[model samples]
Target: MVGRKKRTTICDKELQKEDLISNLHEPLISEILLRLSTKDAVRTSLLSKRWRYLWQTVPGLDLALYDFLNINFSNIDAFFKFVERFFDSHRESWIRKLRLYLGYRHHICGLKSWIDAVTRPKIQHLDVNYYSSDEIPVSIYTCETLVHLRLEWVSLPNTEFVSLPCLKIMHLKRIRFTSDTTLEKLISGSPVLEDLKLFGCSNHNAIQLRSHTLKKIDMDMDHSSGFVIDAPLLQCLKTKIASTKDFQIISSGFPAKLDIDLQWRRRRPLERPPKKVIRDILADIRRVSDLVITSDILKEFFLYSKSRTVRQFRNLSRLHARFAICDIEMLPALLESCTKLESLIMVI
Candidate 1:
């Protein structure tokens, strides 16, 4: 009778317990919370008192206001004001990143104060994208704690800002500088910098790079222009160009490996090897571990330098090409020169 009574009690509790746990629980993952907009974060206050303060301490703060959504411009100042208020009141100094991108050019003036307020010593990562006729504020450029920075479609003159000591990665897209030395000076200043990217900018004149700690560099060199690489610690390099004759690569030392992508214009005739071009790049690259050449470019390089010593092809592991509406001429000499080639890839 006692055993049967215990079994009967368990059955009765199952139906009662199911109803108690039916409510939906909030998600614990942080990514879902980050996707919510500032407005959505504010709305969370209605959930409970605990959630009210939670949004204030969130790691990421994005303050890019959509002007189209707001009917009146008068409310713009108020939005910026509220954001400034949040940074001031938040006590915790451990904010991981604070990203502020004010899209509209009209509100750039208001950013001066907001930038100064948000760049606390505690903030580790900061990204700002804005357009201004005035110069970049010196205080913004000299941020000691910033590790990654991106300046797009902006201008920074030479005389004002000199260096960024703590920057590790930088992306300058369509950025214009006043002079050639200005860009070089800024690059050399980042002593601990690792990666640098330049896309569609003026003054592609021979750039002298002197980074002791750089690792990767990707540059789309301007045709009819030349640039030099002098980084002692460079490991990977990717360069693409149209006029191979005009492009020159000067390296302090060749990367451990090199991957070249070339696009030949139909108008240029098949001509002799550009001795100046080949010599400039060879001066820096002491050894090329792997060479990936497009089919068209491989033909060009072979045509320019015929029967060159395959013995100098030291440490080369692969020779690959991609053919596009072009016949692959049998160049046994080209393959023979790569004495150490281990594999070849051909994609038609």
Candidate 2:
């Protein structure tokens, strides 16, 4: 037993850990870094020598260009220098995706320079959530390499030339266009665009969305008028009932899943929709496969059914109805109309 104290194992020398994460394959590390926020990814540089430049090799602004550009810094000129260094570092690299939440008022000028720097690279996915009143750089409209673009609350000026051959997805929300034609030009330029989402966008002038390539459209405007969508291959169209109680949807009958949600409002007894009018609207929505509406709308159809006929929803498979107290009795009528409805959600 006394002799047991004599041996010192080699395992004791392994006190300094193996650092298994750093030894992982380079691509795996890059992917892990990609999941991190642009700021957090760059901060890995301070962890160890192996991690120092690995983050820079990660795709897009995972290299953390946004860290220098997006912050509301006190010494913006200094941050601009860091931005220049970031571009210089990536002069030969391909940045596929970049997201910039451009901060409060003061950083606009430097932020534009940051945006300009990105234009040099073959950027595919660009998300700019800008808060400033000034327009984003027009060069963005002509980015041939952009595959996905999201612009929110930014003023977009009408540019002479717009071309995005590779763009497949576009999300435009609360965008202020110098002219309504700017939106038309942008959509027309994105030849391969398949999915488009518009939220809180209002246009007084006529804009034509004539996209053969478009498969899905999600538009939710508080007030929209004089816009037309001619998507022949349209697979889905999701929209809010714009103009308060006026539901106008062009069901192309291309197996499109049209989503309609009716917003409720109090009206005088005389202001109720005419019996024939409700029947006409119901007939128009006969092909909408997905329908979400208030139960009160069912009451309209119920009252109309007593006089004129209610059209059968042959295509409707899903229905989500929010019930108002007085309109709950009309539930049976709604169920009777949607003969093929497989999924029904009745909200109390």
- lDDT (CA) per prediction: 0.62, 0.71
Q: After superposition, how far is residue 133 of candidate 2 from its true place, in Å?
A: 3.0
**Tens digits of per-residue lDDT for model 1 on 1-348?**
999999989987985674443222343423445566555665676665556556665655665566323732356677667766776765455454665656645555656665565454555566666665655555655667777777665666665565577889977766667778877777777888898877767674666766788888777644325666677788877666555533343555667766666554444556543566554444323376766556555555555555443444545777565766454554466567766778877777
Estimate the lDDT of model 2: 0.71
In the order shown, the candidates' Cα RMSDs to the true structure are: 7.4, 5.7
Instruction: Kindly report which residue pairs in candidate 2 clash with one another.
Output: none
Relative to the true structure, candidate 2 reaches a TM of: 0.79
- Per-candidate clash tally: 4, 0
Residue 191 deviation, candidate 2, in Å? Answer: 1.2
Per-prediction TM-score: 0.68, 0.79
Instruction: Identify the leading candidate in terms of TM-score.
Output: 2
Model 2: how far residue 56 lies from native, Å: 2.5
